[model samples]
Structure formats: C-alpha cells, structure tokens
Target: MFWATGWKPIVLAAAMLLASASSALAEEGVPTPGDLLAERLDERLGEQEVALQAFYAARDGRPAWQETATVAALANALRTLDADGLTPQDYRPDTLVAAHRQALAEQSSPAARARFDVQTSQTLLTALRHLQRGKVDPYRIDPGWEVPIEAPPLDLAAISQAVDARRFEQAFASARPSSASYERLRASLARYRHIARQGGWPMMPPRSQSLRPGELHDDVLLLRERLAILGELEVMAAGVSAGVEPQATEPRRYDERLVAAVERFQQRHLLEVDGIVGPRTRAALNVPVVTRIDQIRVNLERARWLLHGLPDSFVLVDIAGYRIRYFRPDGDVWRSRIVVGRPYRRTPSLRSSISHLTINPTWTVPPTILREDVLPRVRRNLGYLWQQDLMVLSPSGRRLDPRDVDWWRPGNVILRQRAGPRNALGRVVLRFPNDHLVYLHDTPAQALFAREQRAFSSGCIRVQGVLELAQHLFDDTGTEAEVSTLVAAGRTRNVHLERPVPVILHYWTVHPDEEGRLVFRPDVYQRDAALLEALDASPTR
Candidate 1:
C-alpha cells in the first residue's frame, strides 16, 4: 500500500518503536550489554558457591568469600536486572531447597541435625561469614617462619613484624599495658615458660616462608593451640601406654613409655624430633577440648558443602600435602601418595569424569609439553625422541621424516611416543576430558615418591601405586583378574576401559581429621592473596 516515499516514513516509525522498546526495557531493569555480561558472571559464580564454600571452610574454617555477601550481591543483581522476567535457564531454587532438605535428613540426632540445617540455611540466605575483623583464629600456622624479637631498644617495626609472626615475645616488647595488666601477662608468660622447662615444645623443622597469606588462618590458630597443648601431649605421650584392649596384653603403660609414645606422636604429627617440650609445642598441646569440637563442626560444614550433592564416586587430590584420595560410594575407601604438578605449572581446580583408561598407553604429547620440554631437547640433540621411544608424526599421519621439516624453525609438529617400559605415561592413563589438559597416569619416575616433598610434576598427577588403583577401579568391571595376570607377565598389555570414574582436581591446603584435630599441609601452589582480597571486598549477604 506504500510507494517509495511512503516507505521512508514507515521505516522511521519502525525505528522509533524499536528505540521506545529498548528504553522501556532499560527502565524495567534490563541491564545494558556490559551489565548483562557481569550478570552472567554472577550467575556462574552463584553456581560455584557450593564448591567455593567448601574450599573456604576447609582452608579458613569459614567461607572465604562469605556466602551471605554472595547471596546479597546476587539478590541485588537480580533485583537490578529484573531477573524474574529473564528467568534462569539451568538454575532451580527448588533443587537447592531439596538438597538442603536431604542434607537435614542425613543428620543422626535431632538437635545436632537442626544446627546443621540452620548453618546450611544461613549459607543460603546470608552468603557466608568471611573474615572477622581483628579476630584471628589462634589455630593458624605462622605465616613468617620466625618472629624477630626486639631487645634493649624497642624497634617498633621489628616489634610489629614479630607480632605478625604469632610470637608472644613481640607482645611483651610492645606492651604499654597498665602495671596490673602487664603483671598478669608476665605471669601467663612465666607459666608458659615453666611448662616449657618441664616439657619440651613439639620440635618442628623451620616451616617454609612460601605459605600464602590467608590459607592458614584456622591452621595458624590450631598451631598456636597445638604449641600450647604440646606440654600436655608430651606428658601424655611419654607416659600414656596404649589403652588396654580386651584381646591384648598390658593393663597399663608406664609414664616413660608414654613419653616415648608422645615422641612417636610428634613424629607422626610432623613436629620436630626434639625430645624437649618448648613454648611452641606446649601451646599446641594445650588446645582446649572445645577447639577440637569446633573443628568437627567446621569439617561437618565442609563435608556438607563439598560432598553432599556430589556424584557417588570421584578422585580427590589434596594439593597442600600433595596426596591423592579416591572415594567410593561405600565409604573412605582408598588413598595414595601422588606427585602433583609443580608450583609454576599448577594443577587446576575442575570437575570431570574419567571416560576411559588406556593400558600400555601411547603418549600423544600435549602441545605445551612438546613446546616446553620435548622441543628443546630435540633441538639440542636429534636423538632425544628415539632415546625416549617417541615418534614424530606429521599432520597427514605419516612418520614425520624429521629431515623434511627445518629443525631450527619454530613450527607445528605432532609428537607421539610408542608404548613400552620407557614410556612417560608408564603402563596406564586415566582419561578425563577437562580444560586443564590434566589426567591421572602412571609415571616411570616412581622413585620420586621416596622423598618427603613431592611437588615435581608438570601438571598431571603421577600416582605412586597405579597398579593397585587400576585393580580397584576394574574390580566391578571384571578386568581386575586380567590386569593382574598381565602385570605378572610384565610384557605390558594395552587394555581399554569398560567404565571410568570421575576425577575432581581441587586445591585445599588445610583440613581436619577424624579426631577433629586441624592439620596443616604445605601450600604447594601460592593462590591465597588474590582470593583473600576478593573475599575481603565482596559485598555482605
């Protein structure tokens, strides 16, 4: 019905209508493109809260980025965005609610269970309680290895530095206390010193200075308490014989024997071998019984957040102490020492399921590995690949005549290694698809397990006991007997998997044990500072 001139008017009118619609959307809280992107990030972050909360609780006895703040920020974003109209595609409030209810059902006692439910609900509503200002957890490990004490002349900087190290010496040096208060503190120190005289501190080697700023908040407190408690533990350990067993020998153990036992306990707890108890060890020993109870509560919260909604089975890699643990549906089933990636090439945090396992696996070297390690060796000596039993393949699938490509040119080339005894992947590979290009595999370098410190891999975990692990995974698949037979033969057999387990590569440097005693592990990867800042600045729920 319109001519060419009439069409121009129609176009203008359409343009106006579109602009009006856009304006209306803006007024209704539909964010701009930039804001929309932020919203998307917030959405994904919201989903990550469960795992994040678990990590936080494990590391600091509370969520690093408080759940309360997160939830509040999310709510604000939702309000600003008018998310009701947009609607979340993959998220469901009812699903979270159902999960909450299921967790509540799992608690054994009604009162205890109610408390658990309250905590969970708190996490949901408030975000989380992150950093409590000025209230440092006494259980944390010392960030600085040693506190620098100021002597005759007061060095304020030196005193402050020492105070930061969790050393009481600095406290005394910095004391501007009233005479009465000073006297009281002096008396406490004297009492501590008296205990130190009778019982030596749990002697521990000088801890490395590489620990991250905030990863060990709870651990620092625990360490302090452990130091306090060491005197007691020493007394207990020196004299405390193993409790009488109905099926066993002695009715009671003597005090000297108990001291010996305490020494053994010190060794097991990673404390120094000094037979004497000092202030540090004494403090650790004097940990109040109530603190252990608190540890249990914190660990419970962690389990609820981390393991509550998880799949039936997965691989858990504890990065701090460099250990790998496997969990089956039944219970705490299996564990092994693993050589994780080095600090420089850190293993990542991710969730993926192992889809397959390859026996006598051919190693198709990842591009990064080739560039960083293999290529340099190849350049230095052409025989490097042949020595390692590796083969160079062209894109066309032919054996790359190494002569064809200019050896000196930076280029693209596929490198594969034939499976044999010398293969880097050793006898097996657990395949899990992930962005980190990581997997669990056997390593030819098995001797590294003998060292106390084991952070030496490129990124993949080099498991110490792959043979046993393989047997365990293949038990239900009926391949365990066959695998064992193959191992006996020692010639290597390539076997594909029938079913694969899930692998969760995570980074947690602190955790509590069954006895509710908080434990410390080396923070092999430094990743706490940025996280701490993020935690501190995050909005409160």
Candidate 2:
C-alpha cells in the first residue's frame, strides 16, 4: 500500500526503531515486542481485547502506534472533542501525548512501547464510539425514550486503516452527526463557551413590576447591557453622540429600542413576544451564561441521540418547542404550532412513519385518560358523558347506557366521542402506528395553540393547521382533494398515502432556527437536568 508522502518517512523511522527495540529485548532474554504487545492487549483491554487482538493479528501482532505522527494526530483529535460538547479530559489527550513521548525516549524497552500502543488504540476507539453514538445511552437516562438508537457498529478494521493512512481527522469527522442542525448547535456551543471565557453577561436585579416600553427603571439599564452582550441590542458608545443630548438616566429608561431587543430575546427563548419584560422574561434573561452553555451541551447530546441516518423527507415534532416541521426533498418546509402532552403526561420520543390520514376522525379516550380524567367528571355528573358527546361501549363493541354503568368501576368499556365540532380530535387526524397510541391530529381547542407553552394534551399531539399538514404529507394531488371532500362530507374516511413519510417525535430544548441562531425552549418535561447528570457521570465502559 502507498502511504501518504507526509508521514511515510516517519513510519519508516518508527519501524526501524521498533526493530531496534525488539533486538535489544531479545539480547536481554525478554520476549519480542509483538509478544509483549499481545500480552498487554489481553491485560489492559477487558471487553475489547478480542477486537484489539484481531486488529494486531492482521499486522503480525506489531504495534500500530509507533509512529509519532499517528499519535500526534490522535491527540489533536481528542483535544477537539470539546467542540462537540464533549470533555477533552475524558479522553486525556495530554496524558496520551506524554506517554507517547516517554515511550519514544525509552526505545530500548519494548514493554513501554507496547503499553503506549494499547493505550493509544483504546483511547482512539473509545473517542470514536462516543462521537458516533454518545457517551450516555438514551434508555439509561430516559426510561420512556422509544426511539431506536441506530449507529454503525464499531469497525476496528476501518479505524486501523484510517490510522495507517494518517486520516485521523477525517475519520473522527465522519463519526459525528452530519445533519445541519447538529452542526449549527455545535457552532453555538463554541460561541457560548467563548462568552463564558469572557465573563458572561451580568445578572439583572429583580423587580416586582414589569418593565414596559416608555417607562424608566434602574433594572432596565442592566437588562439593556445583558441583551447587548447577547447581540440582541445595538448599544451606542458611551460618548458617541448622534446630535441628541445624552442624559445620565437615558440608558435606565425603558426606551422603545430596548423593548424591541427584549422582544427579540423573548422570541429566541420561546417566551411570549410581548414588549413588556415580565417575571418569566426576567427569569429567562437572568439565566447564567454557564447554564446556557450547559443547555447547548445537553441539546448537542440530544442531537447525537436521534440525528443519524435521517430520511430525505420527514416530519419532526419539536416537543419542547411546541412546534412541528415537515421537511420535503426540495428544501421546502411547512411548520405549525402544536400542543404536546402535559408535563406529567409527557410526550414520548419515538420514530414512526405516517402511512394514512383520517378525515373527520373520532376521538377515543385512552385508558390513562379515562381513569384520571373522564372517570372523575362522569362520576360527578353522568350528564358529563352526554355533554361531551361520549358514548360508553362494552368490551364486545356493544353500546352501553351511560346511566347504567358504574363510573367508579367501569371495567372493560370504551369511551369514544363521535365526530363533530365538540370532538377532542377535530376535522383531520394523521395516523402512524406506534405502541404509545399517540398520533398527530387536529384539535377542537384551537386556543391552546395560541399559548407559547402548549402542553395541554393527555398524550397525543394537537396540531394547528393540521389539514394543511395532511395535504403536504399526502404527496398526491388527487388525495388532497379527496381528503377535503371527505372532511366536508363529515364522514369518517381513512386515506392511505402513496408514500409513507417518516415521522420523528423528538424532545429538544435547544435547536437552531432557520437563520442558524440557537433557540432555547423550556424543558417542560424537566428532562435536561437528568440528562445532564447522566452525561456528566463517568463513562460506564
């Protein structure tokens, strides 16, 4: 094989040094370097011993990390792991470099060289595995996560080939997620870390009253400085004048410009865009830059969890963001606000494909909702069933009188709402098969979508402009009209799509907007704390 010219001489020099080391070891009555390397591989590598052994066996049990250029490249790769929201100390690049230098100095000791070689290989493999999948498993952190974590199996052969070819950087890059969203978040992480290094924005003092436009308050000055540091405000220099006299208290006044900047900040944080700075807005602005950095890191870990091998087209439900985006092949995207499950009835993260759409769909209350929601209402007044247009049915699909059934111990019965304006599920329903029985559908309560934090559903997602989304998903010109006709006819009809579009119901507290700016959302499910705890924990391996 032809090695790259840049490192060919270094490889030859390392081979010669290895030969000299082996000859010296033989003179001292010690085993050959390859034999010692095989022994060290067995002792150091617990679960990965077989793979490392097989990798070395292909090269006649020779040490692969003898070349200084290869080890340096591995060290560089480990150092840059921080850019991916990974801790560089976890890989211990400095220790690896120091060990390599010491091994080179003691060229006569095959044992030292063998140990360094094994350590280098093990560290490289671990780093690659973490980059490809993640440091922590999703199932371990989130027991309710249902999305299948798909990652390419670790190929030691390919890694060895890359190291031999001296393409370590390219290999590490290929291991990470390739989606634009992941890359954007990675860039934001770097910027936020830089802000931390520069002593992040100052905290604003608490105030009981909201800061409205054209009002004067001392806290507004601190708010302006905070927003200015975040690039949301354009602050003129202290002495720079634009023909207007600068008053001492002018900055403290809640001017229109500062209000606009606050609105922008509120928009990015997924808070209400009102021009007034209320408690919620103040709380968001007062969040420490270090916390925001950690938020970016946590979401970066989340991006690694689900961004691999995405289809050409798919529907992504940003649960925490309270929004849905349907991505198409031609780069066109359709988006709408959505109401996800409440915090206690948290929406699960899963991947499924939308195969069909139901026009004028009926609503069936799930078991949990029935026990926790409907039973209480019905037990108080049997008239509640009639008010909600819910019909009680036996397990055999036989209709039962609501008055005769015992609401307290209603066993083996179903509560279904007929199709109408009062139905919980509105005019159209997008159906996908999953164990959770949660699907995206139109809701009668459209007012909920207007709220910034839309987490009102039992477990299913209530989508705004769902009919339009159904039109996009249909992907068939004729089926769109058919769906409209069925809905207008007020008849229950299921229309299968010509091509099933993949759907991913995901939870992300931070994601990049269209302009590539990071948008932070409330962790409504309170998932980030647990995930961050797991991520910061020591590696299980």
Candidate 3:
C-alpha cells in the first residue's frame, strides 16, 4: 500500500506500460509517433508533399504541435479564428482535443493521437497560409488578379520549441497582417457581426416603385427604420428610436430631414444623389443586411492578401471605386480620381513595382484591343486613323498606308499614336515591368472624373492628375518645372527611378468612408457574386 509514494513500483509500472505500448505499436506497424504521423500523411494527403516534408523535416521525426499542452493551446487558438472571419470547423480543434483526451484515458489508440497530431500541424500551416494570403486563390476567383507562388512554410520547429512558451497562438500570429487599414476593417467586421447577432437590419417590403421623399406611406416607415439600422439616420436622443417620426403631429410625411437622410444613404451607395428614392436607390436600399455582411466578409478576405510586407512608399488603386491613393510611411501623400476597365475589360488586381516613368509616351494598341475595338471602328470609317491621330505600321516598324490594307482582314499591323497633347497616353505614364503590358497614364477626358462610376477604360487605368503623380514619382530626379519643360518639348522621354515605388491595383466593393460609415459600390464587372461563390468553395485548404 505504501508503494504508492515509493519510486520502485512507479519505475516498474512505467517499464511495463512502455513494453505494452511498444508491442501494440509493432502490431499496428507504427513504432513511433513519427512513423504514425508519416503513415497518416501518406494516407490522408499524398499530394501535400511540400507541407509534409516541411512539417516533419523541422521536428527531427517528432510531433511539434501534437503534445498535450501544445494541442490544448492550439485548440483554444482555433476556437477564436472566427474573430478574423475564419470558419472554426475548418480546423476542428474540438475533435482534436477530444481525441487527445481519449488517448490519455487509454480509450483511443496511438494511431488516433498520431492522426490528431499530424493534422494539427497541418492546421497550423493552413491557418498561417490563410492569415497571410487570404482564403481563396485570388487568381482562381479572377484570372486578371495576380497571385504569387506559394511561400515557404514557417519555422515550426522553432515555434514549437519549449523555450518559446508563446504556444501556437502567439507563434502563428506572427504571420498575420499588421496594417492600420486591415485593423480598422477587422474592428468594423466585429461590429457588423455583433449587429448580425442582434437580428440585423429589417428587410424592406417590395413595392412596384420606390418611395419618394415627400410621400407619406407605410413603406416610408420601413425606409426610416432601414436607414436607422444602417446608421444613416441620426437619432434625436440616446433612448429615442431614430426610425420613429414625431407622433401626434405628422405620422405620414417626408420632411426635409428624411430627404437629407435619404440623400446621405444614396451618397453612401454611390447612387444618384437625388433626394427622391428612385429604382436604383431602391434596389441598393433593398440589399439585405446579410448580403452586406457577406460583402464585408468578402473584402476582409481580400484585405488579408495585401496586408503584410508593404513598401514605405506605394500606390493603391481601388478599381471599383475609381480612385488612387499614394501613400508614404506616415499617411496619404495624395489622392486622385482614376478610370478603371469597363465591365467587359476589367482592370485586374496587380502587385508590381514601378520601375520607371515615361514622359510624352506613345500609345501602341494591344492586339486584343485592335481586333475588338479598332477593327470595328475602322471597318465603319476608313478615315478613323487620320482622325484619331493614329498610323499603321508594318511588321518591320515602317509606316504603311491604310488604303492599301484590307480593313476586313485580320493582320498584325501595329497602330501607333504620336506623342502630343491629344495623344491617347496623355503626358506621363508610370510603367511597371510586367507581362500584362498595362500601365497607368494620364487622360484628356477630365470630365469623366466628375461622375460617380467611372469604368470607362479599355483595360489600362487613366489618371486625372497624372502630372502630379509623375512629379511625385520623379521626386529626386527632377522638378515640376523640368517635367513641364520636357512635356512641352513633345519628344518621347523615359526617366528611370532611383528607387521604384510599389503599385497595387485591387478591387473591393465595400469600404468605410471618411466618417467611418460603410459605403458600397456597384459590382462594376459583376465580380462579387463570383468571388462569393469561390469563397464558398475555398475551404479545402
């Protein structure tokens, strides 16, 4: 009886248990945790060779995250992945923890524990990938979007070291994005989820037409409630409901205040700023709160892709919003209106460095543009080339007469436009070394910037204040006076940058406005639905 406190019985008991475990493992053909983990890796994911090799190569054949304390830590971490808009079921941390407990109780086999340990390592890897690069492959969602090759796996051996007691949570968190914009969106996502849990905003009843500002109908009451829940309508007091109109005076009246609120909502949605709710405004307002919640979630996924390792100075182009923002380390240096690709020809998400700037740039139409756009126009009017200040060049770069060529037939003749004020590529062009052959340049059509939705380009982006952008890029090389002189000279000039600035062209339908109110834009190319569907199918990783 007193042997409970003695060391001899304990040592013998441990020896017997080890002998039994060894016999059982040999019977199962898995002698150690490493052998079981390897067997599970081969059985479950034969194609995940890279992850498997990376996972085991670091641990010297031991389970890095499969130990009891480590797995419990991972379980706690996995439970909170929803805070970052991730699905907890994707990791199945509860099942892993439960199985580990079963193994400790001798109810589960060593194989089960080995399987849990292997998958937990895989879960860490997959979750890290998600935190760094987004859930779905951006290129698969939209072929125009550029996605880099898979980055090397993290140093899991170091992360799982006993000396570093941060566990999976703190260790894996090192891969998360650390940007202010991402943080702000994360905060907004939490608030929106809270709103969702509270039953979200009410759905507006369908009417044949929209409710005007001055009309006094029951639909107007619903609209008031809708705007109040959307945070557009300002309440009179903390306790008072913003949706409630003043009682005993005018229960059914569209006062100027309501009209103003409607206008604000329209502005938030990039709709026509008319106080009256028309069909377009009505359609926007009728979008369900759940749909907006999904929109926020979709954009949050995109935010993860661009969150980390950004340059000190860079440019961000919001494709759907038709805006460009230049940033330094501190804040936005400048912002300009931009025209992105049309519905058919969308501007793709790109991440590239601006290597050089081109002044008095010439426009050479791409083959696709020539085949689709120029050919049709030329077939109609033979004088299109002369009118548009364009010329035809043969294969050898010699000028050719359009009269001698057949406009109906397809050929590889290049269309070159001269460098001038009316040139398609206005004064300066910021060139990125890419295979896509798309560059940011100026445009003469300044009036288009005044419109809310500006998806008017073929594919290349057209900048409003392109001169300022050029001058900004030419920071140490030259001055505004020098660039102005160069532009006036009318000769083609290519100026190299001392240090290239990074440029990212991305798309997002929802973002917070200046006042931190969520604003939405039209899915110009109808991309949101496709992306949402892709996200629905993106859980395999």
Which lDDT values do the candidates have, in the order given?
Answer: 0.50, 0.82, 0.75
* TM values, all candidates: 0.50, 0.87, 0.82
Tens digit per residue, CA lDDT, model 2, 179-198:
89988988888898888898
Segments in model 2 whose C-alpha atoms lie over 4 Å from true places:
1-62, 101-112, 152-167, 236-249, 476-481
lDDT of 1 by residue, 481-539 (tens): 55556645555455655666766665544354334334434456654433333322424
Residue 40 of model 2 has an lDDT of: 66
Ranking by lDDT: 2, 3, 1
Error of 3 at 107 (Å): 6.8
Residue-pair clash count for candidate 2: 0
Off by over 4 Å in 3: 1-73, 107-112, 147-172, 206-213, 236-251, 329-332, 476-481, 538-541
Segments of candidate 1 deviating more than 4 angstroms: 1-124, 127-232, 236-305, 329-332, 403-405, 477-481, 485-500, 514-516, 538-541
Give residue 232's lDDT in candidate 1 (0 to 100): 25
The TM-score between candidate 1 and the true structure equals 0.50
Query: What does the lDDT come to for candidate 3?
Result: 0.75
lDDT of 3 by residue, 87-186 (tens): 7777777787676776546565545655665666677777777776777787776766773533344666665563136365666566567666666667
List the pairs of residues colliding in candidate 2: none
User: Candidate 3, TM-score vs. the true structure?
Assistant: 0.82
Error of 3 at 326 (Å): 1.1
Which model, 1 or 3, shows the larger TM-score? Answer: 3
